[model samples]
Every structure is written in C-alpha cells, then in structure tokens.
Target: MSASVKSPRDPSTSFDDDVWPDSTDVLIMGGGPVGLSCAIMLAQRGVDVLLVERRDFVFRFPRAHLLNPRTMEAFHDMGVAGDIYGATPAHDRWRKAAWYTTATGPGRFDGMKIGDVPAWGGGPDAERYRSSSPRAFANMPQLRLDPLIHRHALAAAPGRIRSRQEVVAIEQDSESAVVSVRDVVTGELRTVRARYVIAADGGRDSADLLGIELEGPRDMREVVNYHVSMDLSAWSEPDALLGHFLHPAGGARRRGTIQALGPTHYNRDSEEWLVSVAAWMVEGDPDDEAALFASIRRMLGLADDHEITMHSMTRWSYHGLVAKQFRDRRVFLVGDAAHKHPPTGGLGLNSGIQDAQNLCWKLAAVLDGQAPDGLLDSYQAERRPVVAWYTAHSLENANRHPPIAEALGFCDDEAAGFRGLEVFVSETPEGEAMRARVAAEVAHNAHDYSQLGVEAGYHYWAGALVPDGTPVPGDPSDPVTFHATSRPGHHLPHVWLDSATGGDGGSVSAHDLIAAAGLTLLTSESAAPRWRAAVAAASGNMPITVVAIADDDAAWTAVRQIDDDGALLVRPDRKVAWRAARLPADPDAELTAALETILRGGDAPAGDPAEPYLRRIRAAANVLVR
Candidate 1:
C-alpha cells in the first residue's frame, strides 16, 4: 500500500499517554541508512520498529561513495550483504579518484591506488570474530545502496516503513517517548508513543524540534554536484571513476564519470551514459551545465558532437559538525543528526552506519530488560568522540592544497619550482622517495578509524564493564599493532581457530564464536571444575556461554597462558568485560559482579591482585605460582 494513505486514529480505543496505536518498541525518525539499519537489526531481534521518512522515496543522489569493512560486517549480519553485492555492478567496485586543476584542465594528482580487492578483507570469513580483515574500504555510492537496505528492512518487517510521514514533535519521560507525526499527503496527525526514539533525521526539520543543535562551520565551501549524460568513449581512456583537470591558468575541477551503471551499459540509442562532476565554485552562475560540459569536452580534447543530458544538479555545503548531545532522556540522536563531516575522505555515511549498529544492540538490550540504562551512555561516549576526530581530520584534509597549486611555478618561485619539479620527476632514489613520500603523506592519512577507538579499540571507561587496572604481562602495543586482542574497550581481534570439532577442517573466527551468544566466558580447562559450575549457574540465571580451554592446547597457551590469565569475560559487542587469573571462591559472586557491571554500565571492581587472582599459570611447571 502507498505510504501517503494515513492510518486512522481511533479515539474509542484506550491508549497509554506515552504510547499510541501504532506505537512500537523503537521509533526511528529517518529512513536513511542509519534509521533503516536500526529497523533491520531491531526487527531481527523481534522488537517492533517503525521507520518514518520525510521523502516519498529513497534519494537517488550518490552522496556517500565509500563503505568500510565495519559496515560491511553489519550488513552480513542482516543477511543483505549478498543481495547488495549481487545488485551492485562489478564496475562500481573498481573506483579511481584523481585531482584536476579545473573543470577543463590537465590532471594534477591521482587518488591513492586502492587495489581491486578490499585492503583488509571481504566475504563471510572476514566477518568472523577476532578476524580483523585487511580490507578497509569499498567504493559504493549511497544512491544505489540505500534503496537496497531500505527494501531489505521493509521485507524484514512489512508495513513498518512509513514514507511521507514527518515527525513534528517529541515528548519523552522516564517511561516512554511520544512522537507526533503528520502524514504530509493526507494532512493527518498521528501520535506514536514508543519505548525508545531514535533521531536519525540527518539534521533536517525533525532534529530541530528536539532542541539539538549541529555546531560547526555551515559553509566551509560550496560544491556543485550533478549527473550529466555525454558520449566520451572516443577518448580511449581507462574506465576510472575520478578524473582530474588542471588548467594552466589556475584553479581545478574533479569529475567522477560512471562509464557503466552496474554491469549494464546505458542504452546509447535511447538514453545516454551518465557521469557526475563536482567543481569548487569561487563565485559565478549556478545553472551553467552548458559551460561545465564545454569545459569537460575541452579537457578531454573531444569534438563537439557529444550530446548533453542533464539529469540532476544539487548545491551542497560542507559542514563538519556534531550534535550537542546524542541522548536526552528517551530520545537519542544518530547519524547526521549526531555528526556531519565533509566528503573529503568519504567517512560521513560509513560513520552513520556505524552509529546505527552501535545504537541498535544497546536499544534492544534495554527494551528486553537484559541490560541496564547506563549502557546507552556508551553510544555517545564511543561515537561522539569519533565523529569529532574524523570531522577535524577531514577539514584538515580538505584544506590541503595540491603541491602544484601551491608552488605556482609560473610565478614567484618559478625557476626553483620548475627545477624542483624536474627533480621530482627524476628517476634517482631521492627523487623517487620524494614523490613516494608525498603520495604516502596523502594516502596514509591519520583518518585511520583505529585511532578513534570507536570502530575497533573503544573501551568502556565509566560504565559497568570497566576493568580493574590489573597489570597483565603482555605487550600492550602488540594488541593494536599485529592482531586484534581482547583488551578492555577494544574489539577482540579475530583469529582463525581450529574447526575440527565442527568437521569443517577449516578455521573458525573468534568473533563468530563469542558473538554467536550474548556474553561469553573463556577460561582454562584446569579451572574447568569452577568454570563449569559458574557456567551452570550463569546459564540458569542469564544468557551466557562458557568456553573451557585445556592448559596444554596451543591456542589456549597463546591466549590464556600469555599473562597467566585464567579467564576472560567477553560482552555481547565483543569487548572484554572482566578478567581473572583464577575463579573466585564463590564463582557466582564474581559472575554476578561482572554481569552487574555490564548491566549497570559501570566499570569492573578495582582491587590489587589479591594473591590468588594475581597468580601466574605455568605450563611447564603445571602449577599456578604467585
């Protein structure tokens, strides 16, 4: 049924003050990637979810162009990764970005060559726990991807996504959140009282009602983005998405041409091929598609025989801002509502998708009464800092002018700059190193998500899972460097464990094992007696899994024996909650303490190594020696 048809509100039926007839466990105020993702995950957990969008349909503008590995893993869980992969054309995966002097100038710089395969890893195995796949980024535009996810979310729960329904106001209390939405087409007003309200409204009209302010530079720069149809196959250039034009006079323009949409070529006889171009405007006429096309043709040195088909044009402002706060009572802001950044590094959409994944599980746990309210605080604690860091870094990146533009060889340092350029092009080791260093400086930027800690190494400092500052003897740096480690606040690094038990002979990832269940306890087999008892108690009381490892096993030796660590508690999100050298006298007390910390979102108890808990395990000696 069309979303414009509003559902009638009945006055005869009794409804709670905080909730209405169409009220659900979670009400998502945005049908973009973030909101849709939340709906997909919440529905999977059996929580009734409603996603409302202001637009009539998914937007077709290709805003975001990169999807990171972390987001891909989330899609894998939702069972739509394969569908997205199949629907996306192969050419879309092979992207090439470059820098140009102007809309019609020669090339100046090229994007760091991201190889064909994902730099970290791809596929189902990459999603395995403890498996930190090597691939980092994928070149997929949001215009094509958002629709796929929206369809999947609706399929997961039909009649849940209500487009053309704009949220007007929100009222929240200690019990629930009530949102008043209007059906734009029917002019009908309906109130939905939900257990939780998510503000994924992307800084549009809805976020304003919640008194959320997006603080940052609104107009850092103005960019013109448009999709145009033109025939340029005669140039015989490689099918690279990004092309750079450098005008001898000065100023530059970057064009991204999609030679083919997915696997199929545009019907040349009926419809022309499309290419997107973005030019930095100093000041001039906005509706200059003819001038833009003429510039492109001059840059490509093509004849005037090509026809121009202007599809859509949009003017956007680059603003890097984060909301004042992500949560205020039962209303929580996410995605663009939480943060917005420049498209320099293409981190905006990926960051929002991460926000959704981070918030969904916490919201579900709170609704199901599995976790305490404090868990929600981690969402802001973890993501807000990340958003701030990336935004700053992106602004820095955008401000960096190309070496060619800075030198202005034809002017002031003309001779020295030309000489330097000659030296830069030399084949000597120093020359090669100079060019490589410049490329490396641009490519290996500090935009590494690892630094933010939200994507990989974020640890809970104030909440229930804070660990006691016990000194475990192991290389702290190694955890962040070589492989994933179950360090406090860091995602447990993925490792391939022997899958002999499952008759697969292949390897299973650590993530798949621990993440399969809610909370997991990894303990030594020597402590199996106490561990099994604790497991029995925990199983009866709460959702938990206990994995016992023998002292002699190599895998156990590598993990448990390293710091003489006897056991480690992993949270549902795959972060370490607690650790001990040996089981406490009353295992339930320790288990309860750990569970309470996680549920309350408090740090684990702090204490000195109380002799037994601090004892070191010796494999050769076959004894726990303090």
Candidate 2:
C-alpha cells in the first residue's frame, strides 16, 4: 500500500501558542527545510524544540528541485519520504532534463538529454540505491516541498516553529545562548534561552551575528528568475523533459540563455510556466524589466506580440562560499548558514537537510548525557571537509558550462557572439566538429546530472567515527560515481535479506533495520545471543540493538564483507563505527570500549592502535586538553 498522504496543518488541527514550551532544549533559527528538518528530528528524539521563522508563510516559489538519494534516505529515516513522494505526483519521465534551442519551436535542433536516470529508479544506479536505501531520488518543486516539511515539523512538535517571528539578537557565553525574537506584525519582543542553538537561518546575515565571515567567492553570477504563466502547450513535445536550455542566439547585445521550468505539464487551457534569464552582467542593470522580457521572449523564439503573464521577478546572486567556522561557542551553523554554492547539481538543499541529520542525533546523544560535551566538537571536524568538497564540485560544474558555450562559438566575452551558431547548424566540416564537441561536452557532464557518488559516497572521517586499523578506501576520481563499502568510518554496505521482511513480504533495506537513535549490531545467529547479551550489558546508558542473522545468510554477510561469526557496529546515521572480523575473547569488554571511544569523540583505550588517529581528530576539533 502507498503511504497515506495528509497535511499536518489540516483545518481541523490546532497549533496554539501554548503548544511550545517557554524554554526548550534546542532552539533552531529559520523555518526553511533545514530548520524544519532539525526540529522534526529533534522533536522525534523527544527533545523540546522551538523554531522561529521571519516569514509568515512558507515561500511558494520554485527553488531546489532535485532531492538526491541521500536526502530521500534521510527523509525516509524521518518517516516522511512517502509523503514527499505522494506530494510530488510527477512521473519519472517528467523528471528527466533535456536541452533545447528554443521552447517556442523545438525539433529544429536535436535535444541534448541531461538527467538520464529515471526518477523512481531503473537507472544505472537503481540496484545500488535499492540495496542502500528504500527511497529514490525525487524531483519535486521546492514550492510544494517546503509545506510538506513545514507541516511535518509542526506535526512532530506543535507550535515549535513560529512564523513571522524574527530573531533580533543572539547572545551566547560558555553555557547557553539567549535569543531575542520580535513579532513581525506587532512590535513585541521575547527572549528565549537554550543550551544549544542551530543557525539553520539561511544567508550570511545570521553568520554575521556570530561574528563569522564567509570564506570563498561571495558572488559567482547574477540571475533574474521570472515566474510566468502562459500558454506554453504549443511549445512542448511528448518527449520534452522538465529542464529546457535555450541556446545562445539573437546577436551579442540581445543574446542570452534562458532555462524553461518544465517538464511540468500544466493543463493546456491554463498553461503556467516559470523560467530564468541568465546573462553575464558586466554592464547595465540585470533587473531592467523591459530588457529581461525581451531576452526571455527571444530565447523562446516568440514573436514580439506573444502573450505572456508575469507573476513575479526575483534577482539573486549565486555564491560559492563556506563559513569560516561552522561552530562558534554555544551556537552552530547548518544549511545555508554554513555553506552556499551554485545550484548546478542541486546539492544546496540536500546538503543542508543532511547537515541537520548529522547534527540532530549527536545533539540528542549529548543532551541525554549518553555522550560528553566534547562530542559537539566533531560537528565541524566531520562536516567542514564535506562542505569544502561540495563547494569545489559545485564550482567545477558551473565552470564546465562556459566551455560548452565557447565550443559552440557562443562566447559572450568575445566581440562576435553566437554568430557561429548558424555555422554550428550547417552541414560543413566546422559544423560537424561543433556537433562532436557539443556531444562530448554533454557526455562529459554526466556527473552534473547523476551525482550518486557525491551524494551517497561521502564518508565521515572524523567526529564520532571510530576508525579501525584498516586503511580507509579512496573515493572515485569522478566525484559523482559511488562505490558502496562497509569499512569502518564508511556507510555500511547494503544487502537484501529475507529476515528483513515482514508479513507483507516486501523486502527491506538493511538500513531500515537500524533505529533513528541507537547503535545497531549485526551478526550471525550463532553469535547473536552473545552479541545481544554484550549489548545489554554494555549499553547501560546508550541505546543499542543487536540483530543476529541465520548462519546460512551467506549472501548478506558477503555484502557486508564480514564473516558469519563477525560483527559490525553501525551508528545512528547508518555509518559503520566499528567492526569485528570475529568475536573477541571478551565480547562485552570489546563492545563497551568501542561505545566509550565513539562517545568521547574517538578516544581509545590505552594501547589501542587507533589512539593515534583519535589524537589527530582531537587536534583538528580543538577540544584536546593541554
């Protein structure tokens, strides 16, 4: 059966002001996807959460559209993926992206497909993702997504997120953070205090409050996004995908690329559309209404009298930046507060949601007294390097676009621009060369479309991860191709097992067996009883669950690359913290020591071989005592 779809903000439901407590365990700023996610995860963990958003309602604009597998897996873990899938109601074919010369009259130029992978699976990485997660990539407009998350956040913890509430000032010391919030409609102010705060509030303004500076390029380019509703049915084809790329045309002064927001098939009678006009703004105003409209109309091959209704126009500056520090004293940054990048691969929202996933469980553990305060230091140590890689990858994806334009002789920087486009479509030797180069460029950009490795292959090397003596595996040369493995410090490999099924007989991802907040132990049935006993004995304060498979489950064991008698310890985030090739002489002691090491941010028992690695992490986190 499909998951039931319901809005938490049903008219019958009530979210009164009293639903939130005066004081909370965690205070999250911003009610964007990241903040809402943090609130939902924290509330689900039984943490009192309060979230404040300056906006009165969720933004109803098309923003991030690509929800990668990892983000879907995180939503699945939160038990919201099905609702999100249901909310989208778009087919796999609609999710595919194609480049077009013009939306008004296509087929004159052959289409260049970009998003080749199926949205709901049957793509090249389908089996791998099927093994790793129960969820797949989703291409839903952010306008639809934000409400689902907003409703979920409120449902999980009613009144936790108060909209139209602006955070005025934040004061923090060694123990807690005091936040001053103001009512947007009424000039009322109230102060709330929490032991820890999450700056999920997007933009660099929040960072400024903490005296943090963003490091890296502040602006890559400026774009004007036009939300238009018009009769575009005449321009669409049965094979057209959601994304349409307008080739450079209309001479240098009038030449600019336009992206059609599609394969959104609005009803023909009431056709509505959204598109962005992007140009290198070296001179003149980027937001000149008359100029912007002409550029859009020309790119679409529309006549001067074409009827187009404009709803709204927003000018935005793209940035490739990361906060100099993710953490400052008692406050920690997440989402756009920590990093910003071009949306070439649609990693912004995905990374932000995962940032909440990474920090939520750790915060819960520490708050519950299952871990020490020092464990907080791992947040930056583990997330910074990932953000750095994503920033560079986003930059690379953005940089590759210019080469395609240059190869097509559409170099806007040159005195003669897009004049070669005529020759590019001709039957001459130069045209053939341009065609080959364009095809090669399109193929070379496969990573920008199917970024499985960048989305799923990033393994946390520090923070609460306990590295075994085994050497860590290297990532693929291509940032987007993933290799699943279960080495310590990496995500546990995925495998299908009948024991993971239920009365319905639907197969489950090994990941589904793990809980949202606990240590999961996987071992053979013969050792299951012992491991369970060890877990029971060792988990005096921490949460741990042990599962022992039958000795005949060789296939699953092989996927894990562990002996039937061996064991693997998985953290709450579905990452392998420690693994034993075989049961140690003292199972309880070994398991107990591993738990302690992880809770203490990779500390090891005296004489343990991993002590050196732990020391290095300590130095990087800056939490080591003199």
Task: Highest lDDT: give the candidate number.
Answer: 2
The lDDT per prediction is 0.57, 0.68
Which digits, one per residue and each the tens of the lDDT, describe model 2 over residues 103-122?
Answer: 56533442322212332233
Clashing pairs in 2: 242-262, 242-263
Count clashes in each candidate, considering only residues at least 3 apart in sequence or on different chains. Answer: 36, 2
lDDT per residue for candidate 1 within 1-626, as digits (tens), equals 11011221221222333334666788988898888998888887667888889887647676675565567667777786776666543543233333333222123322212111111222321343123532234545566788888888877756777788899988888889888998888788999899888888886865668787766555655565655556545432334444433333333222233333332432222123334444432224546666666644544444555666776767677676777678888888888888876765556887888788778877766766666688787677666665665566556545433433333232334355445445555798876766665455433322331222323433333343656565433443221233345555555555445431435655555555564325677766577567666656652223566766545556535544234325777765566777665657777677776777666666422432111211211111121110
Residue 621 shift from truth in candidate 2, angstroms: 28
The global Cα lDDT (0 to 1) of model 2 is 0.68
Q: How does residue 598 of candidate 1 score in lDDT?
A: 68
Cα-based lDDT at residue 178, candidate 1: 85
Candidate 2 lDDT for residue 625: 10
Reference-based TM-score, model 1:
0.76
